[model samples]
Target: MLYGVCYYPEHWPKERWPIDAALMREAGVNVVRIAEFAWSKMEPRPGEYDWSWLDEIIALLEANGIEVVLGTPTATPPKWLMDRHPDLYMKDAQGHTRGFGNRRHYCYNHAEYRRLSADIVERMARRYGGHANVAAWQIDNEFGCTDTVRCYCDHCRQAFQRWLRNKYGEIGKLNEAWGTVFWSHIYNSWEEVVLPAYTVFPMHNPGLHLDYMRFASDAVAEYQQVQVDVLRRESPDKPITHNFMGYFAEVDAFRLAEPLDFASWDNYPNLHFDEKADPLNSAVQHDMTWGLKRQPFWVMEQQSGSPGGNFIFAMPKPGELRRWTYQAVAHGADAILYFRWRTCLFGAEQYWHGLLPHDGIPGRRYEEAKRTGEELQRLSGRWLGTGAGAEVAVIRSYDNEWAMDIQPQSFGHRYMAHFKQYCRYFYDRHIPVEIVSPDMPLGRYRLVVVPHDMLTHPASAAALHAYAAAGGTVVLDFRAGIKRPDNRMEERTIPGAYRDLLGLRVADYGSLRQGDTRPVTLVRGDTAAEGHGGGVWYDIVELEGAEAVAWYASDFFADTPAVTRHAYGSGTAYYMATEPTPALMDALMDRICEGAQVEPIAGIAAPPGVEIARRTNGEKDFLFVMNHDEHSATLALEEPLDELIQGVRHAGSVRIEAGGVHVYERASLRRD
Candidate 1:
């Protein structure tokens, strides 16, 4: 229930601090985050430290009844530190150094940089760990922002060599795992290994490239662990988190969040007033962040107005910002903090508008935010322990995503886009879904969807097989289990590890050109429906103790199984040989969910442009209905409920305006 803004006392004059604090309190802001990017201000010299300004702001905000979430200033080291150690700069793929003009320039593997980061984090934690107003600590700014996750510097190269040595144990094992015999690229010694950069062409050894990605991700995680260890020692009572960016997959978010107490994300949907955007784009990310820890999270940097950097985006409509905030909460966000209280007057982010304008005038956006805060205050404490209960989970794999990026096989075959495509169907029907990693247990979910997971581990395959055998439905698509964890092709048939579980084998496959599609016809007992297929790739699937639910209608692969279903011990396993059209996917999901007895959250499909979700503790249940369309939506209620936002009771039906949100609490019904 923490509601606030990301304030920057360092960005304003000292005299304006009091006024800002008062205005924030009046606007119902109960918390504020500061000093995530104020390294230079905190540490002016190499070893000198200054906390006068920060101390004053924290004390002033506390007096005004606002708590503080202090962040480690390690994201941006002081110019003095960078100037002293020039080798700390991260080198790009072309061996060009990323200079100090922007943030996150320091290489994570650099020894000097790690030491300095640890020193600054410990100093900040020790100074404010016991402060009455300090509530939590953020480890660093966005970990992989600005493509800084991958560094080709000598420090990273050496660290990567050590990492490979640790993983493979010996050079001969590394050679065998990487399949280095094909290109005669076998390494004689550990020193001979190099990063996958500056190759003669874009093609680097697939095994080497995949390992480098893992090594780089580990390096970043280890770097954060250093600060995490220091903060836990210094501030054991405070919670820790790192703000992750939406749709960012440069580093493994699950791994990054493993050390923190909970998860938080920076949500900037960047939707304008007139733009026709998919609401699922933001909803899926919220689910992803929530799935990181499987708990309620915080929106660390919620977009208040138009977001701008290299290019400016259109401003949100009057009620759009409030709707976006409600959307975040609808998923799993227990706390919401707007990106900034006021826009900056100078710097690259000068044009990034906040609640208040650049003139520091409390205008339309500020009033809207104030109204949201007021409404939220009335509804506080009721939703403190509630979280989404999802029966369907979409399996996510960072390793497979990275492997696909290395060799996409065909154009427009994106990993994330494919994930969204499948999730969108469930979203449209208001079915609660969770995005989970494949390594996690699958028994909790009734249906598990694994889409285009190219690199499959044996343990993950075994888990899926067991889940299906134990009365869970599993849906897998083409190119799944085609490669091993080492990024090499499986020695067995296509769909290597999944062959037995899926009850099918891929005879052959081919990539389709853009704007070309093969027709498919799905047959269910007494009816058949035709739909388009193959926007990216398709596989000719041969049935093995399975039933063909769909078949290609045209092209050389006509009459072949495009989709199949096989009943394992107590459950069913479904497989897709090609990407289906939206209509076809809907039909497929309908049949699968019907068999699994899964239903939408509202007991029926929601109207177009309307989104529905539910959150509940063991006692109380809350339903969120949002209308993202341009016109009003009228929904029929199944039972009596209280609309908490406006404190109205509705039993028959309710009309929601455009860009409106309604939160309903069931009346007189409590579970034991």
Candidate 2:
């Protein structure tokens, strides 16, 4: 595994370079990422280039036995290029040009901006492609940060029209697909089409809005491909990657990662610190990143300290940083690189702390990171190729997320929140899960949980049907398959395409006001419990060929089916018509997993705040047990295992302190 920090050599003086390099080497950091936002330093003029400063820093780090990961400066184009062609700036939805005072201001569709970005990337690749010290190349910084992915400039408008033309083949087909007859918005020619912006009201045609999102995502991916082309030609041996942000759904990450060698993500969990939810949320993001290419990934920008630009964040107390580092590794990250080597003294990110404080002294955070590095180095080769072995797959779709964003039927219906809630259930039970794309094959998974897939493609619907038919259990939440791919409501019954597999039809549905809920009674065998439901929305189902496992006990839909189970072929398909309380969700998952024969990691019954995940390489199993609580947790083991971190062997039981982690390796799989 590669362990390092994100270094900004341009921020410090020349005399401090060697000191930083030596300190990093002492801390067991083998790599440093530089030049992501140093465009101005690289090119003082339009065509003039300077590599002296960067060259010195790279050479110094190399001498200290540290490798380098060079980032293309395309994220922050030099002001010289923007000043020459003012049209290169991105125009916001309100028809205002976002000038070059900040980063990510260039429009992806602007011809001049694309050419200039490719030119700079090509220059960087050629300069460092053959350097033995350069380990990998990162293509641009966070691709869609600061809401820059959606541009409404004339360049984008023209490009969008051409994209539509290619997708639909003709204006008439476009009209048909977009259902433009609803508002007499039929187009006569490609020139008549306009980017979805500045409408009479806040609403744009759903179909048009959805298509625009697709176009924008494609534009960004196309822009990255241009840089990827240059890098492949210049640096064929070095791996190319882009750092994706957590919970960022504006662009299709799977598509963005398609052309790269592997995927990496910037994890700043401090920005989303919740005592109970943080671990599950962080694990989901890590798994999502790994699922991008289904391979081991790197934590390109791991939060080192309290990250702040607009608002200050809570500090990671004592062992929290170490815990978070291990958390990332436990999920699937093969490498961990803290955000920065030292806190900056000036700029908007001056308050964003790093491993070292502003005084450039190694402090608490630095020492903790050093200890983690040493620990990880000790177990390097043993777990390098192992990956998370998950039997449950959670399906996530950008199209569905975008559809919900365009027209979220209820005020409390958030696509990502609902999706994460399903993952949380499995997480709480210590069941390993893999967040996967809807288009991927589902045969490898024993259970598939799809939450609120409002806009479902026919291919995805067919895949789910086949999976269930082939003895794979499927659990779908409310609003599944209500709309077509064009973001138009299906003319058939509610849960249109999924009705056959679910064996039920929604007779009626309504959104509940905030703080209002109806009671739901669920029965499993002889056990029955009453739980609250419908804080967001509720659907009244009239069963056709399914059994009602749960029913509403209040409201107009009282006693109607709120949850159902249908025997479809050799497997079972379960559906929940409303959002259930935490207790109810846990109960439902327990029942579902029992039927699916999916067991938690090693079948170990963990405490409430303890998390268990396993990584395996078919021949060996490595179990990562984490304690997220404030108190110690003692877990009973079924067999003896070798603890790699402390180089100790434990059997019967293991004790972990608060915010502690343990990695146990065994030669045979526990499930086997």
Candidate 3:
């Protein structure tokens, strides 16, 4: 495991570089990331370049035995470049050029911008690519931050049209795919097709909007590949990765991760607004990032202290800084780096706290970070190359999310919220889960859950149905498979392609306003109970060779099926017809897990406020037990086992302190 921080040598004076490096070494930091936002410092003018400063910084860090992860500073274009090409900036849906003052303002499709970006990346690679100190290359800071994805500029419009032409080929096919006849949007020529911007009712043709999302995401990936190709060509030995933002939907993270060596993401837990930071949310984010390449990932930029920038800021408790760092490791993070070495004394992030405060003094966070670094070093390499082995895989798709975002029919219909709810339910019970794209292979999983999947790709749907038919349990939630890949409504039943496997069809459904409720009664093998659902939407389902597990208990759809299970081929498919509460979802998950024959770790259910994760190196399994709450909790172990952190062996039981973690290597028994 690697311990590091995002360091900006350009932000500090040359005289202080050694001082900062010494402090980092004192804190046991082994790696430091630089040059992510230092484009202006690298190239002060359009044609002029300055490499001496960065070369010195890299040499300084290398002298201290700390490796470096260099970033392509394309995220922040130099001010000179932006000023020279004002037309290269991204334009809003209102067709007004978004002025530059912030980073990530460049239009993705601008030819001049692409050329400049490639030039910079090539120059950086040629200069420092082969340096022994450079271990990895971060392509960009964050690919699609600030919703700068879909642009209305002429460059983007022309690129989008070209992309459409390549996809559809003919005008008639384009019209049919976009369902253009209904809105009188039929295009006579390719030039007539414009961006789905400024629609009259705020909702354009669904297919048009969906394709725009695809094109924008593809453009970002293609732009990244240009840099990737250069880095691979010049510095073939160093691994390459991009720091993805948590739950960022602008670009398909999974697809972006496809070309990289591995995956990584920035995590800011305390987006504090008086709301309790749910540690499970961060866990899911970590799992999603790991699932990108089905390998362990890095927390490239982790929150060190209070996140304050024109927002509410709350300092972490004494033990929280260390605890959260370990929490990242617990969830398959091979490398954990703090967001910054020191808080910036200037710019919009002046208040965004770091391990070291702006005063350059080692504060409480620095102390905690030092302790964490020592602990990680002590346990180094024991778990490297090990990955979380999950029994359940939840299918997540950016295409479905994009489709839903284009038209979220209900006020409470949040794409990520539903997906998180499903993850939270299983995760809270200590049942390990992997959040994968719909296209990933599903046969290895004991069960598969798809939540509110509004759009369906034909290949993915076929793969899912095959998995279910082969005896793997599948769970499909409401609003799933309602639209085709072209974003057109299916003429068949709701959950069109999956209807046969589901053995149920949506008879009627309605969207519910906030606080609206509907009573659903469970009826499975004489087990009967009532639960309230329908905060977002509810469906009245008609069974076709399926057994009703639950039915609506009130309203016009009274006694109608709300949940059903069908035996398809050698397996079963479960359908959830409404958005259930956390408790209900957990209860249902328990039943589903039972049917799927999936069991919790070591035959134990994690205590409340505690999470359990298991990672295996294709040999032995290491269990990561994390107590999230502020109070201590006790656990009973079946046999004596080694606890890595405490360097103790426990037989009967152990008490985990508040925000404490225990990594245990299960004991092996012999039969004589």
Candidate 4:
């Protein structure tokens, strides 16, 4: 594994460079990411360059046996550039120019800004491309931070018009796709089309907004591509990457990750004192980021220490930081790098702490990071090139997410929340899940869950049908297959073309007000329970050939089918018509898992807060047993285990302390 921290050599004086490098080597850090926000230092004046300081810093770090991951420094253009061309700065939808002072201020579609980005990246890459100590290159700090990805300036408007022209050939087709007839907003010429900006109450044509989102995300990607092309041309040997903000929905991560060698994300858990953080949220986010390319990724910017401030910065307990670091490794992070090596005393991020405090003292966080680095070194060769494997897949779509954001009928509708709840069912039981794109193959998994595919592609639906026909179990919740790819509602019944697999037709559906709920009595085989269902929406179902596994017990539509199941070809399809309660979701998932014959990593009787994940290299499997509870617990193992961390053998049981992690290799599969 690669262990490192984000280092900003420009932030410190020349005298502090050697000290930082020596300390990093002593802490066993093998890598460092440098120059992400060093644009001003790199180019002080137009066409002027300063390479003496950066060269010395890189050489000092290399002499200390530490490699470097140089960043393009395009996220933050210098003040000179902004002052010279104010139009290059991003402008909001209300026609106000978002001024400088913070990072990511340049408009992506600005011609001069794109040219400057390419120029600086080319220069940097050419300078350090062949350095023996340089391992990789980070494209920028963060792509879509501060909502700067979308710009409503005239330049962007023209660019968006051109993009629309390229996507839909003629004006008539654009009108047809946008359904402009509804509001008399038809466009006769390309120039007549403008951004969906400053609309009445910020509500415009849903199709127009959806297309604008796509255009904006594409603009960001296109801007990054300028830098990427420069780096690839100047430094063909080194790999490229970009650190994404977790759960950020502005720019499409999938599209941005397409040109990179692999993906990486920043992980910052909202850790509060005396409260156990939900490891599942970060776990799922990690899984999602890793799934961007279906490969093991890096934690490019992990929180090292809590910032000293009044805002949500709670210090980590004794072993929490180290345990959280290991948790990232458990979720398939091949490289883990903290945000900063030392706290910044002069900047907007001064309060955001690092391994070293503002006093430049080696504190508890530094010691803990050292220990974590040592542990990583010890387990280096054991799991090389190995990553977590999964047998269950959850479907996610950027188009669906964009559609929901465009016109969320219910006030409480959040696509991530709904999908997270669906994945929680498997994650709670130690069943590793691959949060996959909707376009990927589904035949490899025994079970596939579709939480909210509001704008499903016909190809995806057919793929799911084929998977189900081949003896796979498919679970789909409310709002599945509700619209076509163009963001228009399906003319057919609810669930659209998937009606055959669901074997049900939605007779009626409505959104419930806040705090309103209806009871559901779930019955399957000999198990029966009264559960409540509440959310923004619910659907009343008419079973065609499906069985009513769950029915509403209260409200005007009492005893109506709330959940249904149908057996098609050699498999089964389960459909949920409403947002299920946690208890109901557990019971329903239990039945679905049984039908698919999918077994958890361990038995189902395991206690709460026990996280089990397995990583494999086809010949060997390493099991990671993590205790996330605040209290100690005993874990029972079915097979003989050789503990890798402790180098011991245990056949039956082992005691794990709170926030402890145990790595074990099955005794039968141990090579030595």
Candidate 5:
């Protein structure tokens, strides 16, 4: 496992390479991703290519035992290609073939684009084919168009027709699925099937336009394979991948992960991670990354200090990076990586800081990186094959993600938001969890929490029923049933016979005009279901035999049960009529989380925005405490926790600075 970061030659002089390399080595950064956007130096013309500079740079790091993840220079295609093959240029949604200055401006569908990019990849593959230090190949950087320019060109149209024919077998079915009868949108042949870009169709149909996005991504994946095909011809053993952004709706990571050997993601959650986000919600990304590849991966890009997202992307406080890095490792990162070794000199990212500051004082940042490096060296070879052996599975299906988004709803109806919230609850419990597709088996876990999984395949619905029949608890909630991807109701009410288990069916749910508090109080104050489970709730249809455990006290839907508990065979199904207020969710989650006998993570009473995650890999269990608070806070732990970054040990008490992170490791516990 190696820690890596991208170091730009243009950002620093040639003389700075060795000193920077030494600095990186001292901080435990064992690898460097080189040659991103260095097209001017690598290729001077359309046909003429130079690798001398690249070779020397590769050699410099290899001499220091540092691995290199080579990035293809196609990200910033050479000016020669841009000026000569203008057709290869990407035209924006506003209808302008964007110039070479900005990144992500290349239209992937152009003929000249494929030919020129192939030539560049061919040259790099031929030269670096035998380079030992080159660990992986980075295909064109961050592939996707941000602005809403739907590429409705002839080439894109033809490609889209082919993709649809393959997916649906014929245009008749496509017409039926898209409800083409609604607007006389029936197409007799594939020839009329142009891309849903700005020109060909109005930008109104996001569902249809979003399919065009899938086609565009397929085009990009084809380009990556073309380069991978060339690279393998030279060196077949090397793995090739592309770095992805988390929750990056632009290009679906699930689709992109199929082509990659493994996956990498850039995490730069702007102002919101601290605003009101669950701590474990942050871990979903890293977990998804590792699950996509089913192996450890590199933390491709993290802001050293402040990102470009917010007006002030907010500096990471003391130990925040360290805590976040360990979080990455705990999820599945084999390597610790950052976006840059030093700050960018020019471009829009100039303000993005790095390990060494602009004031030429590498003071605090360098110290932190060094400390992290030392910790990695200390826990060397500790978590090689370790993973969170969670018996629980949370289903994350793309079709479900889309269906949840498609239903005409307000802003809070985000699918990932709900999944991440419950995920945070499980993370705090030190419980191992896996995010599987809805199509996967459900029998392995005692509890399967289906958070807002609103769509269902017939087979998926059946599998879930089988799991529940076998005594596993199946949880369903608001927005659990909507139309299938084919624009038909798979099941409007949690589908697949879940109404029997859930004790209710959701007809339709919407916001209440007036805010009401229907507090959940215990009638007996001693029974298991008696605590604060009642609250302002989502109203829905209650089945005949279901018990009204919690009811709404006020709102138009008053007297309508907001929450219910149904007993089917030996198992129970819990349903929340609408999104629960935080207090209600917290109390209910505690009730459900009690299904497990293990005690929760103890010790910690700090300000809001603080998150704690505990996970075990190897014999040792590690706790990640992140104080997203503005000022410092003290943490008290009963477990013997060792702060891996600095040599600090704690039995009962520890001090955490504001926005700081702590990785506390303790001796392994063997249950057997």
Candidate 6:
């Protein structure tokens, strides 16, 4: 396991490395990612390099018993590169060429840019390639920024044409998919199609822009590959990684994960979003990291505590910070890292703190970091290399997310909300879920949860229907078949593909809004109760043979099927018509849970400010229980456990105090 920080050695003395390392060691961190933006210090002039600064920093840290994950400084082209080879600068789609100013500004498609950037990468690796402390090599930072600022220069235009030729094989096929015949948008030649997001609102066809988005993502990967391929050639023994921005739709992570030796990402949430974040969002995002290689990756960046001001208005009422951190570990992160180990003095991000606050006082922020560090270190090794095996798998697709967002909603559709609600339902259960690719093996789990049931790949959909048909339960949510791959809705109420699996036709899909919820009554044993109403989380299901599991009131569709269960083949399928409240989701999930015989880690509670997660390495399991809440609850633990953080080995369940964290390892697995 690796808990690390993005450490900067510049502007600080060599002694600073030791202090940070000691602090990190106390926090259980064994890795330090250095130099994503150290170009100015590493290379003083064009075609010339300086190793004195980086050398000392690397050596000092290595000698102090810390591992290093070095980075190529190509993310931000040095001021000199831009001044001399201006053509190497990136030209935006709107046709504005960028000058050297911000990081990740290089035009990925530019010949000169790749050549210069590749040279720096080769040079950097050649120098530190042999260093024993270097565990991995990170490529340049986040790839595409303002999606519209992509290169549409002559180079991109020419390449885009050739790329189109290879993809569609002819302009006719491309024209048909993009609906170019409409609005006089049909192209006579491939050159007409431009990259997506080049304009605020696309005046042309969306498929043209959609294809461009896919192409641009691949282009960014091509740029990352330059650094990665070079590093592999230069240092064959070291693992290679790059930090991806969390939940970023740009630059496909699944495809990009293919080139790297492993995965890592930066987790920055909407400030108010921390608490509001559905647990599945974090799970899905982190699972992307874990699922990339199906192994534990590093936590490259997290907030130590709340930022002083919110992006809008919500504030982290103190304990929320701790809850968020433990949540990461619970999901399968081997380490916990923040954006900076030390606070910045002047920058767009200077306001964010590290282990120390900007005020440099012995105040609340520093104490929280120091305390968390000590707790992490104490809990080290006990949970390292642990795994949280999930019995339920969620199917997520990059293409699906892309396709869903591009369509205009005639019915006021919100993709993000629907997906979040569905995911959160499972997340609240602390259910370890494997967010598999659309085609990954489906039999390893007892069930699967699919949200926004649109564009189910032919083979993937078959496997899904087969899962339910084979007696495995499935939860399929909203707009499941509203659109085909062509982005056009079929006239049918349900897709012909999974007719038997669902056993019902979605006659109408009413908006399942948060405020639109009405009183819903449960129908299962002792489960019968009147609960809250969710306006439209799903739609109206006209039962072909499925039983009416629930209904609506106070509308023409009142007494209509809002929820239904269909026994198809040897299995069962549930179609939710509208968004159900948390109570309803739990009730529905419980039935599936009973059938699957799946139980979450025992005696677990994600109390208001506290979060719980289970991790396992083989059969040696450990439960991470954390209290991010200021006011503590007497947390009951699942038994026959020993405390890793406190180094206290005990049997059976125990109580966790406020602002407290406990990592309980099974006694039999330990020799200590």
- Which residue segments of model 6 deviate by more than 4 Å? 13-29, 85-100, 145-155, 196-204, 269-284, 305-324, 358-378, 408-413, 491-493, 509-514, 518-520, 523-531, 603-609, 637-640, 647-654, 667-672
Which of the two candidates, 2 or 6, achieves a greater TM-score against the reference? 2
State each model's CA lDDT, in order.
Answer: 0.87, 0.88, 0.85, 0.84, 0.66, 0.68
Tens-digit per-residue lDDT, 1-672, candidate 6? 465677888846676667766666655566788888888888879757788988887887777677888878877777777777677666765678766555666667887788878888888889888789998888877656545235667777777788789989999988887777787778888877666536656444557666666777788888788888888899889888777655677677778888887777777543444455443456567866777667777777776544432133243335544555677777777776766677666665566656565643435544565566666665656666766777777766766677766763424555656566656656656667776667677777777777666765678778877887787778776667665565555556674456667777876554443355566666432223656455554466677888877776545666777677788777778777667777777787787777766666565555555556677765676777766445656655555456776777655445667657777776323111
RMSD per candidate (Å) reads 1.9, 1.8, 2.2, 2.4, 4.1, 4.1
lDDT at position 292, candidate 6: 68
lDDT of 4 at 253: 87
Candidate 5 weakest lDDT stretch, 10 residues: 521-530
| Residue 82 Cα positional deviation in candidate 5, in Å, after optimal superposition | 3.3
Worst 10 residues of 1 by lDDT: 523-532
Per-residue lDDT over 622-641 for candidate 1, one digit per residue giving the tens place of the 0 to 100 score: 88898999999888887667
Judged by whole-model lDDT over C-alpha atoms, candidate 3 comes out at 0.85
Q: Please, what are the lDDT tens digits per residue for candidate 4 over residues 1-672?
A: 789999988888888888888889989999999998898899999999999988998889889989999988888899998999989988899999889878898888999888988999989988999999998999988888878888999999999999999999999998988789987998999999989899778888888889999999999899889988998899999999999876788988888999999888988775445345788878888888878888888999888877544354766677777888878888888888997799887878887888988887887988989998998889857766666667789877877888898877777778888888877888888888888888789877888998787887889889989999998899998888788787877888888989999999998999888656676777432323644454567898899999988887767877778889999999999998888888888987898898897778752134799788777776777788888898998888776778877888877767889889888875223221
lDDT per residue as tens, model 3, 290-396: 88998989999998977887774777778887878877887789999998899898988888889999899998999999988998899857778777678899887
lDDT of 5: 0.66
Give lDDT for model 6.
0.68
Superposition TM-score, candidate 4 onto the true structure = 0.96
Clashes of each: 0, 0, 0, 0, 5, 20
Which ranges of candidate 4 are over 4 A from the true structure?
Answer: 271-276, 307-312, 524-534, 603-605, 667-672
**Ranking 4 against 6 by lDDT, winner:** 4
